[model samples]
Target chain A: MSDAAARLAYDVIVDLVGRGSRVLDLGCGDGLLLARLMAEKGARGTGVELSQAGVQAAIARGLSVVQGDLDQGLADYRDGSFDWVILNQTLQSLVNPSLVLNEMLRVGKSALVGFPNCGHWRARWHLLLTGHMPQQASLDYRWYDTPATRLLTIADFRSYCGERGINIVREVFLTDPDGGRPTRWPNLRAETAIFVLAGQIEGRPRQRP
Target chain B: MQPRSVGIVKTEYVELFQPPNELRLDSGEKIGPITVAYETYGTLNADRSNAILLCHALSGDAHAAGRNNEEDAKPGWWDDMVGPGKGFDTSKYFCICANVIGGCMGSTGPSSTNLRTGRPYGLSFPVVTIADMVRVQRELMRHLGIERLMCVSGGSMGGMQALQWTVDYPEMVLSAIPIASAAQQSSQGIAFDVVGRRAIMSDPKWRGGNYYAFGDPPLDGLALARMVAHITYLSEVSMRRKFGRRLQDRERYGYDFATEFQVESYLYYQGDKFTQRFDANTYLYITKAIDYFDLAASKGSLAEALREVTAKFLVIAFTSDWLYLPAQSREIVSALKVNNVDVSYCEIESDYGHDAFLLEVEEQERLIGNFLSGVAREHGIA
Candidate 1:
């Protein structure tokens, strides 16, 4: 009955957030991770969900969530308003994941981004044999019906961080929620990846750029 | 966790202030000997921090839940959400719902006699605003010896009171849930109220609100006002779905305006039933209070108005509620964010319109119960 225990990502996410921390969860479906974080870590969280049902479900669980689109941007929030901003299994589906990640960094002291690694062994084998976009546990739909708008791998995301001058403070590779094995080659072995990041700290007030 | 129903509640009254301790209105005037009619469920814990004050909407009375007696055909207005394990959960938290000061239902409204003239105060009663209503309730809370409340909540006008409590007495309220309401009255809402008040004032029998002395009340005017007010509470979708072009009783229309449609009959029935219990003067006064309500008028900005609010907030709006649209609730949420307040918002998907707060019981129960549970946990209520 406790859906919180069923998701291993929630355990890892909850562990990363500090006790009594203020959290902002983007694309927080039903707020399962946020709810567990509140109960276990005594954290307070606000969620933004595009789906009405997800918003209601989050509210039903006693978490404050707003019905809003991620593409619309987080203009309503102030700078560094939250201790942590979380986006789990939702980065790849967004219209502009990079912009959202930057906005998250602006509004939160730290950001946690989780996404499915498209370069996993299963996805690679399926694409090589079938010559069609692969679908597996993380990508559980046909190419046409998939919500994963873009494909990304552990390496692509790391390079994106480097190019944008974003710092990856921590990284975790998971084959699946139940399979928490750490891998030497995440892009080839891991089905999913989570990264904790901090935006480049300003050394001093920028003088014209 | 589904809450079990708590059955058979009771209502009581308490005299809060008298003479020297007269309740002061936001307008600087004062009223003496205020008697608050209220209903309480569950027991107040030793610390008394488990108390929740439930403020009612326009026509709602203090009878918020449970049946008063076996003869009563229906339970209270919020009966579904205020039981043993329901949204307000009478078992764990002490719930208090009071009839507002200007209400006609067993409260010191215009219907009460004026000690100076020994006649119903009627139009002579000083006009009170939403802030005045909250001030009276605060006095009532002091009378009951509860220093701090676990939560203050309501929808529509009730939501205004909840919001006001947070701004006016920030230290008293621990949490606030303002459902389907706004920080200020919308122009469209004011227009509706204008027509309703005109309906009463234009009636010949109204006699400038002195109809009480004649004992022949302006039932037609009051009924018409209620009819006009009721239309705003529903949406076009609900009206189309519920009545459509369906005829009333007869197979065919009478070819005249003799209650041809079922929707007409329903409105007439609702309006007629309303006249039996409500006072016309009270309708005029309360509606005026709602019209005059603008929290930011004196504070310069909404953020400034709510700067003192420390209580955690949950602001709810319904998608189909055009009277108090979701945008209005967003204004509140935006201001709260500007002040860096702890706030959460949800625009529920409902076609029930302004009445969704009353009709969407299942959704309200879950959301409210969980919110209250978290707050209760924080206060060590469990």
Candidate 2:
């Protein structure tokens, strides 16, 4: 995409958010996301990032970022402190993804979660014949460097959301197999999956420090 | 016309009732049974509702507006904004401006006698914060018999104190205008202060911050600190406009440490001139006070601390101010908004840097005048 296109998209997202709403972004790489949101939306954002370089970059970008191990917990932030907590491209990287999802549900009034789908038929064949973890376009890295703790399929995600009573406000499926236009059956054909969650809450858990 | 100067409260009366004082700073130090010095213009109404307090910046004195003497070269800094039919319009409001707690002017400062030591406190004066300055102002207001103020206004360090007042006694203030100030001093801000203090300490006559006994103050260090800080007060564009690498005497560079350029010479002149009247230790104390001023940290929650502020707010920040920056003003606005405080904010387009608060006349006067008029009308004064 063009640089201007990306910037415009960011601006659109900020415009969608209201002023003074506390925002939390999982895998918040650098604070550009938060700083841009603060400037355009007049919102206050706190980011949870993993890398030292990312944390420093966020601070320089004038966004508040906290170093955290997302796999362990997000207990520091008080419940309901955030209006919309987002986990972008980071759900599948967790050892126990359910625990983190529960924490997100607890802390945020709404959530925006995006993940990669592993239920694609091609991936099933690659796993069945090659007898190795499938290296699809979305999971590009070599086996050693790959970050998928356990692959999650589109069906699996939907079932968990339903069982846990987490409402799916919007579900977006990206089937852009190449650099070109997206196709159908994105869960099996597409590289990325985007889902925005809102409203519903279930499976209440006890508070942990 | 001759510059008019009147003791709003004479020295004797001020000492007796509204005496200036110092803090036993958070660092286990004490400042004074301070002798605050101030001047007032216009008259206080029977209801005392017409009072407007003017908080001056770091280098300011009690002479906020109006001339202190007929022989004075220039009128006070805010004189244009606070006089008959002027911005603050003292004719319609009782305007009060006091030198802050740890100031030099005629107010109690490091030079003020310490009751326990029977000597000027010098370095012994405890570092005071913006909060302490506001507290002292409150004391003065109580002594002056003013129950509530129409407004509290200032820029830079004065802005810091003005904000402290609104948060400290929200009910007492009807309005607050804090211009070109930061909620917390940035790392760069503290770096300048640190270097300034180092400059003072490096001077041979500094005497480890107790130069009063030596009878020779650390003029060199103080001048250096002023030179550093003054550079930050003005923008690069302002400096370029005022002096664009223009030579002071001959056209070519001196090729030495000598200040050959007009800008360098101007800074030197400003520094040397200020050293004649100011104290090095007082610089240390006051700058430390400013550096320590973080309203959020002290109170823990910005929203709660400002929750009681029902007063209207006019928070102004200059675009050219890299020292304070617009972000600080935004933070203040954020806190105020969370508490549902009534406020109007503007990041004024100016290239004069933080000092724009003092230099910009027409824009400032118009905004302040109209604002006060609106508020006055609400109170039935206009």
Candidate 3:
């Protein structure tokens, strides 16, 4: 991600997270986001990263990060262990996004999910005109070497959450790398989508601040 | 830069629990006037906060680093990782390693003379548990004027002590690194220990643990026991790579009952070398202590057991270690997570099996060095 977009995402996350709350960052590369959450939001942060180098770097930063694969599920954490569980730009790469999303909700009261919007107008036009797989700044990898097993868009994620009874508490759409103002038609225009998701809480009284 | 050694160290002894002030064993027995042999590297900071206690594994002694004498051919067992610029980094931290109570290495073990009878205690010595070992180390710590340790770390049996230290004296430890170990000894481990003990007892020279007077200890039996235990310490891959069914000193089998295979010769050498430095009775006691170790036995669950632990943890495991499986370390990590303890766990890629903790020095150096520096920064000791 570009520096501006990354900073904007971090700012949004920091603003949404309550002060001094416990936060867990899944696939926290080098623990940059977790450190920012701790410093800017007073959040007690923990991280789980798969790469050995990432884990080492996170640890060197004095972050509590366990080296683990996200695909294996979050069985180490108990139900509602953290106030917020963040998975940034890593949802599409997951082998079982549905199971992981369920696990995230089970382990945290709220989850923040971010992913590239593959159904953007530019991507669609490129695929239609070129008769090849779509390639955009967000989803730049070729189909053969892409880490994303599930190519999803803003609309696809919204429908999936709705079908699974997940409540979208908040959301933001980035139309450009500069993190311009949130776009109205995120499904077709936005390059990246971020959402604050929670499990079914219709009848329950909200305890979160 | 090449790691500098602590260099030319000496073992020291301290006597604790004299007379009426006796150490109460888990078996409800009391033993007084215990002598603990220990070695220290680096200088203790003024506030005593820079102290890092290093626990030794099953056969390891207090000689954790540096050479005992100028002419000594070999340094301490863990010299590779504990030195001036190595993992423990004596230049930055005060490192201490104490021989366990039931050890043969200059500690008050079965070989120590029982003051009452002026004879080796042998089997008469009260069975010591891992908790008991930590208790002795705690007394040693108090004697040395250290109030809180910067970290407590070790691998295998030593890792058990590190875990026990956190649960036993949570406030005393700031951080912990339990490597290649388990919360409780697995049944397979117990089975091996049992067989080793049986081997020692079946020997005629063992004489019901009264072999000291004869001046001929159970050499063959002890060697056989070491041979068996050593096999568990190595992986099949390591064994294959190291010895691959090749003949020891001959091109072909001699068609006689002799150590023909290279693996057999290696085991024999390891067993023989072990007998030279270790006492058979001490091995039995130490293995028994390892078998009796169960961190969660009294607390009902591992999470509950570690609920009171306040120290940050760094738990490590080796992928090829079937003896102390990576799954066991995961159990520790899982329990620590349940309690919301700040923990870091990694299963290092290694083919060294259980011995990886001792042999995989480069990776350990990087992980431990980084982890300790981070802990030091948090404690304001950096």
Candidate 4:
């Protein structure tokens, strides 16, 4: 909701998008990332968001956005539509992330997924000391009214990816937007991470440091 | 640099039979002074009630039937269908065609002057919807003293605008025929248009929407956009049959991006020719409006939208049109049924894709002419 969080998302998108790939933004709020990708990188792209206000805002910004519900899979798209399909900070909010992610992989050759880490030290410490899920800056809502349907850890995600045979091409560990850089012990410390996954097996999938 | 002049294949303008005209845009912008570039063959009846409106498609102008002078070898694009005793029956109906707004022809669009700034509007033109296009046609008719049109018809984007007229203003139209049109543009449609616009803006010549001063427009981008669209207008089967593995003046590949196959050459020519006439900004606006189109979404449901229409309907779809499939046309028929509207539906079996509605002369003429005559008899148009 804050400007800082939005800017951080934009920066990550800038680093992830290729020079000339067709990009599709899922839950593309206001299409900020899409506009940047199209303008600066010469990438062709559009956004899908359910909110009419968000769609209108994106269109006014001269970015293409189609109003759509996430539950309806990306069946409308032909095969190999986009090189990159992005789901930024919207993975946990979906009713069925697995189904949506599968649809994403079906439509795009690769995907960039960024979400708050449930296994971060702060979150773990809160659960260890108290009995409730930690209310952090990113995941700031309480259990009673939070939009997050599932709380997932970095390890749990990687394990699930392996079980599904989804090749993880690139894994990025992140601290708070303004905080220190990520190092070896990311699972214990980093609050967020970005993963690039492909549906089929490919050479050197991981670009981990 | 010298300006290259190609040989004149065909060129002419259409004269307005009824001089005075008024046009109202969907944005509620109306025009009193009018100029229509149209061609005609037959005479108007004494009552002038046998007028048939012919809607033009996107990137198409108003020149139909023939040129300004009578000595041209070839006729206009749809001349085959709108002739004496033909599908349109120029002998019976005063067929009229006008270039749609946001069109590059004589009609007003982004390239047209702002009238206030005294400069080309460029991106400043207000976004006009399909309904706005119909409003302009209705105004043109009203100015010509035409009340209750005998039948309104067109294909592709023109069909889209015609459909809008039936919903937006049914009283003005007696019978409506929309060919190869979808009730709503799917998300994939929006995606393609978004890419096309992005391609145009990506050109350095685009110059952030101020390219008019540079004397060099974004021709490459516009051409690329057109090539992308041209692909959708044709069927895969047709493409395969016509240009499959046919080498372009060679036995093998050139190891470069030059036109290697016949298909590539055809597409390149189509795109290259298109950029010369179409305003890049108008293409952006019109295509965006098409992407934003959802007749059902506007009025809550397709049935709800058709409930407002008092006119009879005849909708047609091609079997091979992947761009706007037969299922989409059927959706409109289903909704019309729910509203208890008198509607006839037909899905023509053809391999011509979306272009079939434009290219197939005999079949289209027969269907359209018969439908119009039926509407005329019921409505008592002379």
Candidate 5:
């Protein structure tokens, strides 16, 4: 993803998180978003990153980040321990996305998930015209070496959440990364998607933004 | 650039716990007129916020860096990691290291004279625990007028002391780095200590822990104990690399009940060398203290024990450290996370086993240097 899109996603997530909230950023590469949450939103933030270099960079940035793989799950945190759990720009790369998504909702009152939309028009055109795996600015990786295990679109995520009875408290689809505009027909037009999901425990009231 | 040493350091003695006022041990006993042997590197800032306490491991002393005398051939135990611009960074932070009460290196221990009997304390020295060690160090810090420490760090048994400090005096420690250590000593670890103690007690020259006047201080027993404990500190891979099944002196095996293999010869040398400095009684007491360390035993859980700990933490483990496995460090990290403490954990890849904390200096330097600088910034330390 472009730096502008990443920054826009961060802005949206920062706005979604309340002041002084506790946050756990999963797959927090270099802890940039977590640092922003702590500095700008007054949130108590922790991060978990898989890469050694990423964890080192985060620590050097003065951020608390545990070096761990997302596939292992967040068994260390208690239920409702965090106000917000974030998995941004790293959803497709996980081997067990469902487990992590469920674990996030279990551990936090709410969760914010962001990913590049694989159904964007450019990706479709590249695949349809060239008869090869799609590669674009948002999902820019060769099929052989890509870390993404499950390429997904905005619609797919919405239906997956609906099937699992997970509530989407808020949604933002970014068409113009620099402009920060939320585009319609996001599955086809938007390059990236962000969703704020409420905790799905039985009888628990949905949290307000 | 070559790492600069603290250079020509001397061990300082402070008499704590006067006759009337004594230090209370975890075993419900009190000892008086305790002398603490400590060494300091760098200068304590005016506000004293730059002070960092370094706890040493078993068989270690207060001399953590630099030479005690100009003619001394070797530096302190942690010389590689505690100097100007090294991990502890004497140039940036005031580092203090004190020998535990149950120690032989210039500290009041089993070898110290009993004021009443005018003989070595020997078995008469009250049994000490890790908490007791921390308590003495706390008194030393108080003597120096440092109310709060910027950080407390160590590896192995030293790491246990660091952990003990955070729990025993939560308000005083700003940050901690417990490397290659567990919150509790495992049964397997206790077994090793027990065997080592047995080696000392079975020797006739030990004379029921009263070999001080005999002029023969159970060298064989002490050497055997060192040999047993030394094996725990090394990995099979390291041993293979250092000395496989190779012969000691001749190309062919002696084929006798002697130190034939190079590994056997190495262990004998290590054992003999250790007896020259370490006290057998002190070893027994310190290992007993290590065996008694269990951070969660009374608190019900590790998280409960750490709930009041406000210090930021950096817990590190080595991949090949079987004595204190990576899983144990992860247990600490998990508990710290459950309490919402700011903690960073890394299981460094190394084949050096339990000794990696001492051998893997470069990686530790980078991680600890960055972590401490970040902590200093957060606390507004110069």
Candidate 6:
């Protein structure tokens, strides 16, 4: 696969992974992103995939991956064990995205979370036009069979971070990594967004927006 | 039982040290002319980097796979996972399993006569540690011209050796699979071993480890030890499924204490079968060594112990294995994670308990096969 074969969101996430840093990829499916991150960024990577087949595929690629449920928590990992903990395309599928987000920041010095924005204009337009839940490639599955239990938008994530005192170190819209950060209406324009976050220190003032 | 092509399979013995080339034990005692019984499957490539060391658990021999003779009814202990197309995949990788130093199956143990005393070492044998066991295996590897191993894989006590190899000789190993093992033997584990030892020592036939001259050979004591230890290897769920409160060979219990329960009969059979082959003194020595294996205590903490490890690790645990619970494996994983060691862990769902490493074959086969293939690719081993 070419370096550009990764999803548009991964391209942006890979850039922020930096060089030679340790990474823990939560809900790593087939470990493609971790493998790409390792190859391109010189990052030492580990994956925690819940499925046996996914774990097998990752191992086949010569990647280190453990099989475990994210909902059960990352208790096996120590505090700040990894330089970056990534949750890509998996945030919406989590049983408790809030608790998992807390764990991601607990185990990793910095967390990079990528998720589809439910509040995208297309989704909103589909809901307004058809009077039903949106169905798109980013959120492709039917509501009945979908693994996504929680669907949140960029606005929702920003608010959650604010409430949890999580410092948003960096945010990038999937459609534009090099372009200036989408300052005006990312919740409406961006299909998916990646946020680099760190837990706020006790004495420091929280970053609200 | 299926028809499968076998690989190059044979067992051999090698004398590592001589009178001059003494092997100094961790206790600072010396033993030379040590013999190690080993079996190898598949061919070692020119570089000899395709070798995967398979360490055996307690009561396990060097015969890891294949049958010794046509008349033999069963294959090696880990036959399901060590053949041509099996987990270790002898067809692609050269696999070696050696009888540990303090074992009874052909390796120099309490059963072997000491060169200096002209008699079995018995109680006089220098107590061996997990590290010492690895040291002996290293000597065997050196003698075999294997500069580095592709991977070292094992479970339980075997897993301890695998983990020890990673900590002790990190550069020499490319990867490690330590399944159903812990960084240190838990206190509860020690208590079980203590009871096992007590049963052996209490036997009048034991004669303070000088019972080799007698005909009986402390069978009762050794059988009792095996019975106790075997129970620990299995889970309550498995026991309930297999035996429950069922009676042996009858519709109802005889009501007397003469092995009425089917489980009792099964344990008796296991105990009897074990005594037919195993040496009682070796049981004492090996258990003592296993109990003494506290990697964390020796190296400070598990993190400190694994701090310098460069080899990737796959640490496996079983859900119901109370003997070496998943919690223990997690401790090792936590340390590896803390030290930034590349590690993978799977707490497999199984009712087989600690014996799951031996009994629950499919998941391990898949995991190990994939992990080994991955490691082989990394090491450029065809």
Tens digit of per-residue lDDT, candidate 2, span A1-209: 23333344344356556688778877777667677777777776767776645654654454445445688676544566578787866887877687888788777777777666787777788999999988875677767888776678888888889897788876665543332213466667645566667622333453577
Per-residue lDDT of model 6, residues B257-356, tens digit only: 7878889999999999999999999999999999999988877788888888988898899999999989899888878877777788888889998999
TM-score of each: 0.91, 0.63, 0.96, 0.60, 0.94, 0.88
- Distance from true location, Cα of B109 in model 2, Å: 1.5
Ten consecutive residues with minimal summed lDDT in candidate 5 chain B?
B1-10
Which lDDT value does model 2 have at B62? 82
Which one wins on lDDT? 5
Fnat for candidate 5 (0 to 1): 0.66
The digit string of per-residue lDDT tens for model 3 on B1-382 reads 2349998999999999998999999989999899999999999888788999999999999999999898888989999999988999999999999999989998899999999999999899999999999999999999999989999999999999999999999999999999999999999999999989998989899999999999999988899899999999999999999999899889987999898999999999999999899999999999999999999999999999999999999999999998899999989999999998999987888998999999999888988998999899888995
Task: Kindly provide the TM-score of model 6 when superposed on the true structure, using C-alpha atoms.
Answer: 0.88
Per model, kept true contacts as a fraction are: 0.73, 0.00, 0.66, 0.00, 0.66, 0.64
Per-residue CA lDDT of model 5 for B1-382, tens digit only, reads 2349899998999999997889988899999899999999999988889999999999999999999898888899999999899989999999999999999999899999989899999999999999999999999999999999999999999999999999999999999999999999999999999999999999899999999999999889989999999999999999999898888788886678987899988999999999999999999999999999999999999999999999999998998999999889999999998888899987788999999999998888888999999899998999
Place model 1 in a CAPRI quality band.
Answer: medium
TM-score, candidate 2, is: 0.63
Pairs in steric clash, model 1: B6-B84
For candidate 6, the TM-score of chain A alone versus the native chain A is 0.88
For every prediction, compared with the true complex, DockQ reads: 0.56, 0.02, 0.69, 0.01, 0.68, 0.48
What's the C-alpha lDDT at position B298 in model 1?
A: 96
- Rank order (by DockQ, best first): 3, 5, 1, 6, 2, 4
Higher-ranked by TM-score: 1 or 3: 3
Q: Candidate 3, residues A64-118: lDDT per residue as tens digits?
A: 8898888989987887878899999888789888788988988888899988888
Residue A150, candidate 5: alpha-carbon lDDT: 86
Interface RMSD of 4: 17.8
Q: What digit string (tens of lDDT, one per residue) describes model 2 on residues B233-268?
A: 999998999998899988787689887889989999
For residues A42-149, write the lDDT of model 4, one tens digit per residue: 887767776645654555454545455666666655445678989988888998888888888877788889888888898999998998889877788999999886
**Native-to-model Cα distance after best TM-score fit, residue A174 in candidate 5, in Å:** 3.3
lDDT of 1: 0.86
Chain B TM-score (each prediction, in order): 0.98, 0.93, 0.99, 0.89, 0.99, 0.98
lDDT at B208 for candidate 5?
Answer: 91
TM-score of 1: 0.91
